[model samples]
Structures are given as C-alpha cells and as structure tokens.
Target: MAISPQELSLHKLPPQNIDAEQAIIGGILIENDAIDKIVGILDQNGEDFYRDAHRKIYKAMLSLSNQNEPIDLVTLSSTLRSGGVLESVGGSSYLAALVESTPTAANIIYYANLVREKSLLRRLINSSTEVVTRCYAGGEKIENLLDDAEKIIFEVAQDKTKRSVYHIKDLIKHTFEAIEELSTREGHLTGVTTGFNRLDDLTSGLQPSDLIVIAGRPSMGKTALALNIAQNSAEAGFPVAIFSLEMSKEQLAQRLLASRAKVDLHRIRSGKLKNEDWPKLTTALGILYESPIFIDDTAAQSILEIKAKARRLTKQHNIKLIIVDYLQLVKGRHDADNREQEISDISRSLKAMAKEFNVPVIALAQLSRMPERRE
Candidate 1:
C-alpha cells in the first residue's frame, strides 16, 4: 500500500532512540574500525536513523567506506563539505560533539542493535497508523482493505533484515543439493512441470520466480495453451491459480473440459455432444473436479487486487503456479501517470509477485502488428 498523507503529517514523532543513533555515529568516528562493525546493521536506506542529521552523517560515512577511505572526523567532515551540507548538519563541531558523547567504541555493536530495533519499531507504528487512517477514510472494499492491511504487515516482515550479499562457497552446496534432489526424481525436472515434454526439457520446467509470457495475435490459442498448462499442473497435485480477464469462469471451464475430454470444443459450446462423448466428458469432469484448479474471472482487475488475491491463494492453498490469461486487460493502479507508465508498473508488479510467492507466473500478451508491417 502507498503511504497516506496522514502518515506524513507531524502529528507526533515516531519511535526513536537518539542516544543509540548518536552512540553509533560517535563510535564510528572514534574508532574507524567501528564502521565495519555497524555497516551490516545500519546499511539500509539510512532508515535506521530517525534523525535527519544522523542519516546524512551515516550516508557520508558509507561513501568514505565505499571509496576505501577511513571514516574518521577528517574524512567524514570533508566528504560532507564536498557534498555542500556540512554547515546544515552542524559542521565539524557536531562531529566532535558526537565523539565526545561516546564513552567507548567497544559497545558499538550494542548501540547499533539498539538503533535497528528502534527503526523497525518506527516502521511498524507508521504502517499501523496508515491502516487506521484508511479505516476511517472508509471508501475501500472491506476485503480489499483487509488484504491491504495484511500485505502491509507481511511487507514489514520482508523488510526486517538488512541487505543480503552471500558468498559463493555457501551457495554452491545449496545448488549441489538441489541437483542431487533432481537426479533422484524420475522426470528429472528442477521446477514445476508445464506438461510440455520439449519445453520442459529445454527450460527444465517453469522455475520458481520465472515470469513466462505467452504472446501471439488474437485467436491464436494463447489462452488455450495457458489453460492446458494450468490443468496439467493441477492434475499433478500442484495447486494452480488462473486469472482470466478475457473469459468467464464457465467459459474457461468448458474449454478445459473440451480439451481434457478430447471432445469437440465447438460441439461442447453448442451443446451438441454425441452419446459416446458422455463417458469422456464424465471422466474429464471427475478429474477436473478433483484437481485443485482455482479461477478468478474478474475483468479489468487492478494489479494490486491481483497481488492481494494471489497472496491469499499462496497462503491458503500453497499454490505452486499463477496464470494471468492476458496482460493487456489488467488495469494498473489509479495513481499511474499515464497508460505507458501504468503498463510498466503492471509488468514489474507481476514479476515481483512471482518472486514473492516463489512460484511461476505466466502472463499472456498480444504482439502489436507493427513488426509484421515492418517486415
């Protein structure tokens, strides 16, 4: 959810430990070695500092550290001066004062931890305040509002830790173990199977965090292809979710039945099934009924709505895959600058959702005929 105006108003100050922030910077100034120790703790967008001046000071320190320079008073003050903000941040006098306030640099670790804890607390309070303000505003759908609240809380959890930079030595064993697991499986696929033999072999199935786009001209069976993959995956005991902006759930169900039961799609749509088709239709019905294939045929759904619903399915059903029938039909958020910008947001949100749920997202798209005209 976007931050509300209510959150920005100076109604009250958020949670902060000024002493801790001061201690961290003071320790780093006193002992250049302390910068190395606290980088992992205060390395986030400087949100860890509640005071604006402290944030600026820490950013300059980070810059010096990045340049392989020491983080002492001489270097930090000079860097701030070069950036033209030394006077605004209280200058050399302030830097010396921070160092004076520090008893010793040995307790830098404890001070850093204190600052981080206060930062997390501040974020929580601000988020909860936003939710409460929205509740009073009282225009959103109850379900959507609830979903928004849940998403905010979950995002706070995702943002809890600092940046991650892993060494390859640690990653190699994890990769090798994954390979071992794949080798023991009969099909030898490392990701969710799309039920296409050649495609699965080439791409090793649809890996988690993959954003697969199926593009074509209209009436090119793009929706059919996606539905088949969803059907096959659900049949294999992997929960699947389908978001259809171009068709109704009943229509999709009929298509799935016609494809799975090997009956004529036109005949099924026209209610012209022959007597022999009954058994095949009945068997397909049982299979599909038993399989865990969920569909939301909401047209013109906003990207946020899609994400909220998808997150819910991921939590409740542990859905292994998500399929958006067509991308151009989904609406972007209302706050977009223009159509082009909205489309960009929609694409990125889809990619982020795939990573968030650790599942494959297949979005269907239509290619403009400009290429054909050019050719």
Candidate 2:
C-alpha cells in the first residue's frame, strides 16, 4: 500500500518519560577520547570491513534499541557474527577494536549494536543513541522518523552521485565514439516501426521506453493505423503483443487478411468471403500465424492483468513491443471519483511498465469531445 505523508505523521510514537533508572542506564557514559581511538582504528583499517561486517549489526541494534532492549558487548558480538558481519568486514577483532574506541556510551552501545546489526556506519557515527532512543521511546515526532529515514536517503543519494559521476566521465570520453557509431549506422533498430515511411525515418524506428499514444474519435482509422503498424513491425522480425479490448482476435485477424488480400473489411466481417477469397484468406492466415504477432482479445482487462500478460509474453517469446487497443477501457487498482483520474493512472502505469521492461509501448487512446487535432 502507498503511504501518505499525513498517515505517516500520525503513526509516530510519543516520547518516553526518562526516569532515574532510564537515566542511569543511558548515563553510563563512554569518553569522547575513547571514540577517537575507535575512529583511529577504523581510519587505520579502512572502511571496507565496517561497511561489510557492521552494516547489519547496526541495523539490528537500531531495531532492538527501538524496542528498548539493553545492549551488551557479548550479545552485540554474537549478533554481529551471526548476521555474517565477520565474513563481510574481515573479522571479529576489527569489530571489537572499532567499538572499543567509540566515544559515547550511547554511541558505543549504538555502534556495538550497529556492528552486530550491520547498520550504516556513517549514520552510526553521526547519530547519537540517546537521540534515537528518545525518539523511539516517544514515537510522537516526525523529526525523529525523518532522522532515521535519512540513512536510506543518504545511501541512495550517494549511489546516484556515483552513477552520475561515472556517466559524465564516460560521456565525455565517448562523445566522438558515439558520433562515429551514429555516422556509420552499423546496428539494426530493435523496436516496433510505425508504418509511415516519413515517421519511421524521423524516429529511426520506435525505441524502447517509448509511449506512443494514438488518439482519434469514431471512424478515423485509428484501429486500422494501429493494426497496420503492428503488422509492419511484426513482419520486420520484431515480436509484438497486441491487446484487443474492443475487437475479437478473429475479427482483428480477418482485418489483417483483408488488408493483405485487398479485400473489404466490411465484406469479410459480413461472411461474404468469395470462392477465390478462401484461398487468399487461407494463405494470409498461414503467414499471419507464423509471424510473431500475438493477440489477446479479453474485454475490460485490469492494468495488473495486462502487465502480467505482457511480462509472460516477454519471457516466453522475447516480445519487443506491446500495443493496447485503448487506454480508457483498461481498469486501474484505484477507486477514483472521476474517470479521468483512472485514465491518468492507467497511462502512468503503461509508461512505467514500458520503462520497467525496456520495451516500446504503443497504447491507443480515445480523444475527448473535440474536433481532430494533429501534432
């Protein structure tokens, strides 16, 4: 379930009342100089061991501390070793040295817990155990929750920064190489091709992560255009998956046959197939079946079902493109008061799925009550 910010605000625990016992427990203070020693050990040994061994230990310590568990060194080491910290960080001795040098009792306890839990080392170093414990005990402050959440946010930011740095460096070095590749035109375009010769030229074929929305009112050949594009792409050796919410698979196939055989779609639908037409239809069917154009004719499919089917097609046949007949007909998981919101969600999900699978998604949509507009 998606969590709203308001609901999250309501879920925080109230602050605990720190009595004499609590104070005494929290007051068993370790010196700042001792913390410097711990820092020295970590600095000398490097960060790799702590990053590996103490990562989980830190996390579990946070969890246990949040639940008000009194932490001890023996228990911390056992938890650390059990959580695979020894193998990750180098050894148990490294964990002990780091913990011994930590500054505050709270930090020492927290670091010990963290090394056992394998929590984030930087967060452990920066955050005070007293502050974390106070928040966990009180549970009323969003600020406290935000502080805890910062660890994850910081890691993500760091990862993104690293990726961006690498990408920028690579881009600088390979700009000429990329230009050369484009100049040479050495690779085949591996996506669905829109049937229009001029459009195909402009796009160099529809690339993956593309959301091509074809919109039209009644009798504007929207379906025909989509079918033509699907057929053309499939014929060009790319696997295609088509979801037919408005028309049956057989009906769509007959339209393909009529298009191929130069017969009338109306006549084919009306069962007026001629004696000569039988041979042409048979030949068309044989060719269409052999091609990598799969069709699903289920009515009023939910977005989840569409996603599942698309994934299956991708896995089974390596489908490179997906075509949904119309977006408004598809249902979403949310119960919105307006149909527009539902449509928006469906469109968003389609775009997300396209990105998720790295495939081009062409979804047909219905225009509002307005005259035709061209892009």
**Top candidate by TM-score:** 1
Q: What tens digits encode model 2's per-residue C-alpha lDDT throughout 1-375?
A: 986434553575322221221221222222322222122112112221233233354443433332234445555556656766645654556445544544335444333333322223334433544345556578567875777668656753452232100111122232222111101211445445666677887887888998889888767888898888877777666778888888876677667778866778887889987788876665555555555777877676776557766776788888888899988888664446788887887898899889877999989987765543532
Residue 256 of model 2, lDDT score: 79
Any runs in candidate 1 off by more than 4 Å, and if so which? 1-187, 335-337, 370-375
Off by over 4 Å in 2: 1-190, 274-279, 370-375
Model 1 lDDT per residue over 51-135, tens place: 8888989888866754447888889999999989898989999999999999789998888888888887787777877888889
The collision pairs in model 1 are: none
lDDT of each: 0.78, 0.58
- Per-model TM-score, in order, reads 0.51, 0.48
Tell me each candidate's RMSD, in Å, in order.
13.8, 21.8
